[model samples]
Target chain A: MLYIICMVAGLLLSRALRLERIARPIGWAQTAVTLILIACMGYRLGSRPDFIHELSSMGLMSLLYCIVPSVFSIALVYVVTRFLLKEKKNGRNRDSW
Target chain B: MVILALIALLIGTLAGMLAPHSGMLAVLTNATDIYLVVLMALVGITIGFNEGIVDKLKRHTLHIIVVPTCIIVATILGGVVCSFISGYPMNISTAIAAGLGWYSLSGVTMTNLVGAQIGTITFMSSLMREIFSFMTIPFISRYMNYSSAIAPAAATSEDTTLGMMIKYTDAEHVVVSLLNGTIISAAVPFLIPLCLAVF
Candidate 1:
């Protein structure tokens, strides 16, 4: 995929280049770009003629779908990491683990 | 950052409502893919800049696989439960859950497989998943474990939400998050369709 390629390319480029000085700027740029994309997403959603109707009609169902799966994911991951991975509650073994 | 994101969303929505066909809106919407690509590259560079990232990734190669696998199974189980509770049919519910927070792809795919209503639901649900992950990552990382924090992020953990991972968790978990995201992202397309057809 293009996304994967771009990521790998960037990674290789960064590794080859001396970019320590610009790291903060790179982070800022990433955040700004992310904000723009988020705004664009909002624009796309809001520009729909039926935005309000769609939200009102499907919002609850959508929320349900989001919450249930995410909760399950969190719970399961917690169990696995705590029991199987033997990770601590506060994640003190961050790097050592 | 979260506050800024919310403000951007609100402002963008207002602008869209006021000038739905504005040239700026058109440009921003059309160039979304470009923005996304740049974001991905930036994220990659961030990771690459970390001198020890590769070593960390290698250290946890086996453990990395476990996170995504658990997420996938938990998500599907959640879908089954959702189907029973929402009465939306097992296939549709499961398909939506299989999205794994990749909104645009899953939303469009579900739309094509089913219809606009289901598509819209998929879009909103997955979008909510991303937003919720943004809000909850801090708490999850603090109270729960670093790995569990990645669960709410799913596929987006690689790029869109990698910043959160970087901010809240450590380098080791960030490496795991990236791998978890890649695995989940690869699975979403196949999983959604498979859920639709099989369940």
Candidate 2:
């Protein structure tokens, strides 16, 4: 709820304030935030004794469960989008949008 | 960037284990939620900051529809196959897959709708989805179309994972990703319930 609001506010604010000059830096900030979020999640996992104990047993299944879906999604989307992009490669409509 | 991000996570995990300095680490854990909000706002600013993206989005609007449909179908199919191999019911796997990458919601929803057993699997699997999301962003961007790279992140685009996508993909994909995130997030309530009801 608030997340959407803040994001919309930021977007509208940027539009009004002409913040394009600093958009690059904001992008860097996003990467930094992502890194911090990932590390924090790792730290939380480490602190959980139950998770660590169960981690060994669930390791392989967990890996399979995670990788397979992502691989499938990527493979499907990649193939279709590649065909789409290739079709649009001709100069006639290139970069028009 | 992905490697460095993983290294940072490794170090944070090691620190948490060695120190268990619950005081500071607890604060850090709580702070992540706040940080997430800030990041989302920054993403909006970046998106709004770009004046031309709206035009780009209009041109590639079809992508918003096609790509997510592929991801959703693939994810559900994979989940069904995986459930069969793992000796679970197809319904359980479908609900889990329907979670996309939003672990917290999936975890709780599965637990309440099903049992703790399936719920635990949902939590872990979706968490893995998120890890894979962060892991694949750069690699996919390099080898595949930027739009497809967003597949791994699934539902995180509205929040935690959006940043990396914006960093790796182009302006147009970001718009698509935001749409993907919202759609997947919205789908959660309906789809998870649908999977459970069918079971």
Q: On residues B39-155, what C-alpha lDDT tens digit does candidate 1 reach at each position?
A: 768866776766765576678976687889889999999999999988999999999899889776566556556865686577668888999999999999999888999999998
- Runs in model 2 with CA error above 4 Å? A1-59, A85-97, B1-59
DockQ for every model comes to 0.49, 0.40
User: Per-prediction TM-score, chain A only?
Assistant: 0.71, 0.59
Weakest ten-residue segment in model 1 chain B by summed lDDT:
B104-113
lDDT of 2 by residue, A14-94 (tens): 898888888678878877875776566566656655656765655566666777788999988888777765423111233
Error of 2 at B17 (Å): 18
Leading candidate by TM-score? 1
Please give the fraction of native interface contacts (Cα pairs under 8 Å between A and B) kept by each candidate: 0.69, 0.59
| Structure candidate 1, residue pairs in collision | none
Q: Against the hidden reference, what TM-scores do the models get?
A: 0.68, 0.61
Model number with the top lDDT? 1
